[model samples]
Structure formats: C-alpha cells, structure tokens
Target: MSRKLPIVLGILFCLITNHSISQVIKEVEGLYYNTTGDLYTGTYTEFYESGNKRIEMNLVEGKRNGKITLYFENEKIQEVRSYSDGLMDGTWITWNDNSVKIAEATYKRNKKHGKWYIWDDNGVKRYEMEYSEGEKVGTWYIWDENGNLLKERKF
Candidate 1:
C-alpha cells in the first residue's frame, strides 16, 4: 500500500499538470500574432492607457489583409484603411484629433494612386490631386481654408 500511494500521487500530479497545460494552450490559441514574433492569421484589439480602443486590426496567414481602424485617445476615429496582402489597396480616410475629416485617399498595392482630397480643420476643401504610382501625375487643385479657389496646377 505504501508503494501504491506514491504511484497514485504521481499519477494525480501528472493529471493536474496536463490539465493546466491544456488550459494555457486554449488561452493562447486565438492569438494570431505576437509583437516579438512573425505574422499570424487572427484578429487583435488593442487598447489605449485610458481604456479606450486604440486600434483594431485583422491578419490572414500572418499578413495584414483586411480592414484596420485607428482611434484617438479620446476614442474618436483617427483613420481607417484597408489592406490586401499587407499592402494598402483601397480607400483610406483620416480625421483630425477633433474628429474632422482631414483627408481621403486611395492606394494601389501600397502606392498612392487615383484621386486624393484634403480638407482643413474647418471642413473646407484644401486640395484635390491625382497620383499614379505614387507620383503626382495629373491635375491638382489648391483652395483656401474658406473654400476659395487658389490655384490649379498640372503635374
């Protein structure tokens, strides 16, 4: 009986340890990526120190392949962008700290492409420009903060 007692205790300890290990695995199974590690496919939510949502991003097969949203510390949306295979490939919108729309731009394969518009903090149009392969290649417009047309230039 004395020898059987040790063996029984050992078996019980093993069972407890194995159960804890499985619990740890379950806790980490949803993590798609860790900052110190390579890419992973998963969704992650990050928070600001003030307990507000700072960013929400999604990953697929270790690459950023979906929408990303960023927020100011006050919880206002700062920017929203979409990515494909880790490259910016769609519309991106940015807002000022006060929640005013500051810019709207388009991207293609990580390069600025198509039309882009900029606005002042007061919500007035500042400029509109077109780009090809990251270079300003078409007509560009400039306007005053009060919506007054200032100039038009062709690049």
Candidate 2:
C-alpha cells in the first residue's frame, strides 16, 4: 500500500467515528437536554444541507459558556461570538459572505458595553460607536461608502 493511503484511511476513519459520536439534544425551558434526559454539555454542531458545519458552540451544563462559531454555506467563517453562562460576554464579530469583516462589538452580560464598528459590504467602515451597559455613551462616527467621515454625533 502507498504511504498516502494510510493517511487518507486514517482521516476517513476519524470522520466516521466523530460523526457517530454526536448526540441529538432537545431544548426544554431554554435549556438543552440529551436523549437520556440529562443536561447536555458538549460541543453542539448544526450542519448545512450540504453536510458542512453551519454552527459550532460549546455548552456547559446546558448553558453556552465559550466561543461559538458560525459558518457560511461555503464553509467560510461567518461569525464568532463569546458567551458566559449563556450570555454574550466578550467580543463578537461577523463577516460578509465574501470574507470581509462587516461588524464587530463587545458585550458584557448580554449588554453592549464597549466599542462597536460596522462596515459596508465592500469593506468600508460605515459606523463607529461606543456603549456603556447597553446605553450609547460617546461620540459616534458615520462614514460614507468612500470611507470619508460623514457625521459625528455625541451622546
């Protein structure tokens, strides 16, 4: 047998075994439970129709507690978010289908609490704002499509 054949076979075996180990869970009262009626705590994955992973999130005691990643149908990363006790608690970022960053923000306990930015589809920054505990609290800037500052407003 060729040396490459062993590597290929090993990868195929891993994929098959990995797929078989995934368990389906149910949500009840906003918490996830496994088939055994126990709190589900593991990597939860959702797949696109094409068998690609659309979302992957980590759960601890049925609560989201880590980084969650979402992918476009083409398998590119579309968004990434951080959570703590099922609440948004860190940096969140999103990208357009073309792989350009479109938006980014920081959150604390599900409330906007830091800098936020938004970009147009063509990758030009369109907005820059700040928040404190979900309330706007600083000067906000808006930019035109050509990347020129259009307006600045103070809160």
Candidate 3:
C-alpha cells in the first residue's frame, strides 16, 4: 500500500465518524439539528453546572425517537418519557426530588390515552384515572394517604 494511502484513510474516517459520535446538538422548532445543518441522529445530553447530567435523549432524523430522561441537580432522575417523531407516544413518568414517583401516564400522539396515576409526596397513590384521546373516560378513583379509596367518578 502507498504510504499516503493510510493518511488519506485516517482523515476520511474522522469525517465519516464525527457525526455518528455524540456531539453538541441544537434544537430548532422542536427538532434537533447538528452543526452541519443535518438532522441529528444520536444521543443528546445536557449537564448541570455542577457537572451532573441534567438531561439525555435519543434522536433520529432531527426528532426525538426514544427514551428521554431528566435529572435533578443531585443526579436523581426527575422524569422519564418516550417520544416518537417528537411527540409523546408512550409511557411517561415523573418522580419527586426524594426519588419517589409522583405521576405515571401514557400518551399517544401527544394526547393522554391510557391508565394514569398520581401519588402524593408521602409515596401514596392518590389518584387513578383513565383517558381516551385526551378526554376523561371510564371510572376515575381517588384515594387518601392510607390507600383507602375516597371516591370514584365515571365519565
């Protein structure tokens, strides 16, 4: 092989791999883009001033396509949600700073569309609801801190 062949191959490799690896991503109109003005297709992450990860998300073709996670300043996960084509399309969950889950819900095309739940800071479930295309449907239940059902409402 020619000596210059190796040098040319190395430069080509760096250019081809640069976008595939994690690099800073930019969001415009809710879509992600790379510095080269191409649709971003990689993991995007943001960090807190204290050096802890603040958010991490996977993107494909400039749209959020997989799990997106947000964290508290102390590194505890604050929320976890799924997206497809930049819209909420799967299970979404959130927790308090104390690491206790506060809400859980499902979405389809950015609309609430399945069983939903909410809990109090004490880690007790307080509400259980159902949704169909963002409209309340079925029986919704409310509970007290002791887990006793307080009421049920039908739509």
Candidate 4:
C-alpha cells in the first residue's frame, strides 16, 4: 500500500538517525571522550560502572581549563567548579549525597583567597572563614544551628 510505504520509510529514517547519533558518542571501557580531539583538546567524560555519568570537564594542554561538573552515584550533581589555566579561579560548590549544598568557596590560582562558608546537613551555618593568599588571615566565625554565635577568632 502507498500509505504503508511512507510510514515504513519514516520509521526507517528515524532509526537511522538515532543510530548515527549514538555512534557519535565516543566510547571507552569506562568513559567517553569527545570526537575530533583537536577541537575538544583533552576533555573527557568519565562514567560509573553502571554507566551513569560521573564527571565532565574540559582540559587544555593537559590541565583543567574550564568548568567541571561531578556527579554522585545517584546521578545527582555533587560539585561544580570553574578553572582558569588549571587553577581554581571562581566559585566552587559541593553538595552532600542528599543533594544538599555542604560548602561554597571562592578561589584564586588554587588558593583560598576569598570567603568560604560551610553548612551542616540541617542547613545551618557551621562556620565562615576568610582567607588571604591561602592563609586564614581574617576573621573566622562559628555558629550553632540555632543561630547562636559560638566563637569568633581573628588571625
């Protein structure tokens, strides 16, 4: 039937397209890398044994050069960070297994050079510290979950 021919052709087309798209995914024993290595440079995507995405990052000249994202076994995002010339240069955030944010910090050239804040599992501020050139050079504050200031120390 003429109508049946069209339907079969459409289905064939879809199958072929999907197959080609899947083939584009670079495959490894336990990871995937980008095709056209020149364009992607040294970027890679690592996977868990169950085939879940574990980490994705960009690299240039064999060093981390851009944004990186890591995922937990449950496929929840565990952390996100940005790098410049292989050094952490911007905001970095880490999450617990429950997908709750545990800590956030800023860095410059791999050194903790700015504010860092950490929270407990209950979403309570645990401590806040300031850093200068990788040294704790400013005020550090600790607080209870109930917002009670426990202590403050200055360097």
Which candidate's TM-score is highest? 2
How well is each residue in 79-141 modelled by candidate 3, as lDDT tens digits? Answer: 999999889999999999999999999999999999999999988999999999999999999
Residue range 58-152, candidate 4, lDDT tens digits: 76654677889999988999999988876888899999998888899999998988999999987788999999889997889999989799999
lDDT of 2 at 91: 98
lDDT of each: 0.80, 0.90, 0.90, 0.80
lDDT of 1 by residue, 1-155 (tens): 99899999998996685554333221234334444465456775666655577877777866667799999998899999998987899999999998899999999999999999999998898999999989988889999977888999999
> Model 3 Cα displacement at 48 (Å)?
0.6
Better of 1 and 3 by lDDT: 3
Ranking of all candidate structures by their TM-score, best first: 2, 3, 1, 4
Task: Point out the higher-scoring one by TM-score: 2 or 4.
Answer: 2
Candidate 2 at residue 18, lDDT?
54
How far is each candidate from the true structure, as Cα RMSD in Å? 10.7, 3.8, 7.0, 5.8
Q: Considering TM-score, which of the candidate structures 3 and 4 is the better prediction for this target? A: 3
lDDT of 2 by residue, 28-129 (tens): 876877888998899988777567889899988998888999999999999999999989999999999999999999999999999999999999999999
Tell me the lDDT of model 1 at 119.
95
Q: Candidate 1 overall Cα lDDT vs. reference?
A: 0.80
